[model samples]
Target: MAAAGWAPPRLPGFILTERLGTGTYATVYKAYRKTDTREVVAIKCVSKRSLNRASVENLLTEIEILKTIRHPHIVELKDFQWDSDHIYLIMEFCAGGDLSRFIRMRRILPEKVARIFLQQLACALKFLHDHNISHLDLKPQNILLSTPENPQLKLADFGFAQYMSPWDEKHVLRGSPLYMAPEMVCCQQYDARVDLWSVGVILYEALFGRPPFASRSFAELEEKIRSDRAIETDLVVEAVKKDQEGDASAALSLYCKALEYFVPALYYESDARRKEAIRAKVGQYISRAEELKALVTSSSKSLLQQGNPARELLREMAKDKPRLCAALDVASAAIAKEEEGKDDNDTLKLYQHSLGELLLLLAAEPAGRRRELLHAEIQALMARAEYLKDQMKMREAQSMGKEALAEPVRSTCTLQ
Candidate 1:
């Protein structure tokens, strides 16, 4: 249950069909507007009493911000109503789930796919910034994709968003610790750049399959973020250093060095052009890193680190039987190249292989590390699976010549 009121007066022509989601402050339900030809919508119910005067004022401010902006990438707010106990916001429902779930099935999205999604998100952010509105909570869970083929990415859940001049600054910590900018973690005043920092985090996750800073606990995550620590594992450092040593990869090495320098520059300096260039280059590096990391992370080192007996056998087999090892290597390289060239279908295949490999590795690992690794791997695989399923369903509907595709299932609190 959320802090919001559990019940409210039944508004005319609106029939609540199912629960969509529950959050700290509100519960959203899938409902239909019966009077206006039975239009489907998502109604967010918020308790008027649960919110303090300041928070209530903020809600009103959000309403005002929504009313001012009308973009395809921004979710449409249909109506706002309240009785004595609760306030309800009627909005267009996105058939596809949030971005977090989408990312779970696909460990890492390809560069082109991520760029398309980010471009739409960037447009919406730019619109909000132009209006002096800052979406304090900018995470994958708050971003919703409308459908599979026409996956219109829309930003949602603006309850924590605020409006302030670009020049204005306030020292208050807000948003999820994993996505919070370094300055925000330190409780320093930040500008629109804070939102950009969050965008960078999302971009990182899209390419790397995990948040830039991840930890088992919020306290640990906060400390890591506040200290401006990079989540680059030793394997990643070694890979980069190896690349730097190769003359063939010297250009790539320089590009990575420039990107590393740029992250800190945004923290210390306020040069706009330099930041933009850095962001563009960082995006490229993240994409390339995805390909390289996948190869390295799936290699013998990762398996041996988990103490997999099968990996030891596999290694011995490779050394003892050279032809067989070469065949396996060629097969793996071919699959990787195929996935790199593939669009939607290739993405699904890549996820399937990764998921299979992870499960196999997990089964061979000790129990202590197995749980943690399995949880992370499952999250990444599930997100990609959902994305593929959604895409397939949309394609099937189009083949059948349907006027409008059916909506995906909405979240429910319980079986009842």
Candidate 2:
């Protein structure tokens, strides 16, 4: 039923380059867009004959969800088309392959690495949950890596995903058994929390090289999950302790990790109390990094003044602040514009990393007389960030108001 090894000679603007993989009902290929600077994309070609009515609905559902949601950690659906015989879904090409393949190449990842991946996963899940979508199927095979060297993950494959509500009573049995929550395995009602449980399982496997429940049989797996058997792991905590003692580089890295976890919560979260809680965490991560960076900066400055051997490298590091701040200011301004909402996540991430670097530089400045100047600069940056945030809120409000106004017009026209 799949369109395996069936690449058409002429597919409009796309030139099929190579076959990436074959699934049950479709074949994914690397393709180049002829009209757009030959940009590459992963195209999934599915045979129309392969899908029944239910299967077609599922395929459309996936497309609709991708069209509605936009987040950095989610795989992008570049374009899609349907002819008489086939349906093609053009997606972002992830070079590093799937998470499952990554794990196979390296038996187990380090805690710090796993923490970064987990944070990205959490961000994607949080964004989906905010929109009331439940990704019933959450597994390593569905997590695609953007690059191998500096890994960035994008959550893909929404075949079993569905809209969910907090008060919904229906429970459907879906998802892979190995990573499935106990509620799903037991046919009990579940909500968005199931995704969090899957993340926990993934984190455990990433840290320990194996899942907590690695049963040979389905019965055994169900029993393990039902019995509430677990393994305790504190790799993140251990890694954080070590990082806390390190120099500026480690501190800067930690700050990025913190933002990985914080940014999604800050943007998607709705509850006032919960937002305050997340903000406290954000403050804690930033504060610790700033403190550690100050010490590193002061020591380096002292050595540089004495004509230390590593003076050149220290000098380069010191000069990075203003350049980073300038770039951040541009990103912040982009966030203030209504038309740039689609790229807000990327801009926010750039701004966040730059802010962290700027704060590090401020902490490192050893001149007691120049301390107030650095503090004022940091304050100005903070003020700009706050202003951008307010701008985003205003944009959202205006958008909603426009929609509200349009609704009445549509209703009146319909009545006429």
Candidate 3:
């Protein structure tokens, strides 16, 4: 989806070149000084027409913070100027682009390499911490690498940052749900430690190549963060065994199970370094799971088989419930389509429609074993749908590589 304010503004002193990226309220561009030195820079342009009271305050704060902070690891806000139409933040340019693209290009970073980058991030955070500032939106997208070779991490994007002390607390959703701390996400009072939680998530993604709680929606992400770990250790152990035994399907399932706990663990852990270690593991496991999911096209279907038994149990339990039976029938057709190796997208849609009907019924059911069985069946259906989604992504990625069928994330997507 296009963001709110995505227009590029004409600046008198600089020549705006290609677009960089956009956020909810600002669009950044790559520009060069028109003077003798001709230094390259990034200009963040915010359209005045799009700013409300809250966004204006955020823009002001971002300017105030970046202009004042001069740490080597933090992005330098070289200067700022405003016109009748828009607000422009001219800042130092990082050649290698944001960390998200950096990691995507390499697939995953080595632990040693990730450690160096993490240390740079920690240094920048420590500076912020000592100065009583909290960067609430510390995701991979906000971290930039100076150059692809000998890359140096530079922290940027301070629109959600606040000058909260270690003890000061506030209750508001301040950042993206995928990387948000549980306290902030759950709407509890959160302090500077919230940044630490984000730090862990970033570190985890650096290791695993994706966030631990990445989901199709905010609801699913919240559930993963709130749910218990169910002996996450046991899950990782089994995953390790399965991976060694060449069961990619089982291994992928177990790794996802392990990740469901890792997010909550990140919340409660106090020691910073220990949290980083746990987060590192989450990333590696997630990366492996994603890799396994891609290859699931050729791997065994143990998880699919397990989800099948639940489908049978649901059909038996729905003997007296006509609507429930009908939903089960739809689910059966979805399974049939999958077994025939037809269009996975069509099968996924059928499962989604059936699950929608079953979930409403499941919600009203009294506390009993039948309700439990229905819930299990829903989860099974969801697992199948998720597998199909992953299969589609794998195919999409391969096709893009072979035929250049899609736009790269870093290239032009903004409306300006």
Index of the highest-TM-score prediction: 3
Clashes of each: 10, 0, 1
Which order, best to worst by lDDT? 3, 2, 1
lDDT of 1 by residue, 334-402 (tens): 345444545656556655655665555556555554345454544544554553444444344233222
Q: Which has the greatest lDDT?
A: 3
TM-score of 2: 0.54
Candidate 3 residue spans exceeding 4 A from truth: 1-7, 230-416
Clashing pairs in 2: none
Q: Is candidate 2 or candidate 3 better by TM-score?
A: 3
Q: Give the TM-score of candidate 1.
A: 0.57
Which model, 1 or 2, shows the larger lDDT?
Answer: 2
lDDT of 2 by residue, 263-294 (tens): 44444445445545555555555556556556
lDDT of 3 at 349: 91
Runs in model 1 lying further than 4 Å from the true structure = 1-9, 226-229, 233-416
- Model 1 pairs in collision: 104-380, 104-382, 104-383, 105-381, 105-382, 105-383, 105-384, 105-385, 106-383, 106-384
The ten-residue window of minimal lDDT in model 1 covers: 401-410
Q: Residue 299 in model 1: shift from native, Å?
A: 17
State which candidate, 1 or 3, has the greater lDDT.
Answer: 3
lDDT of 1: 0.66
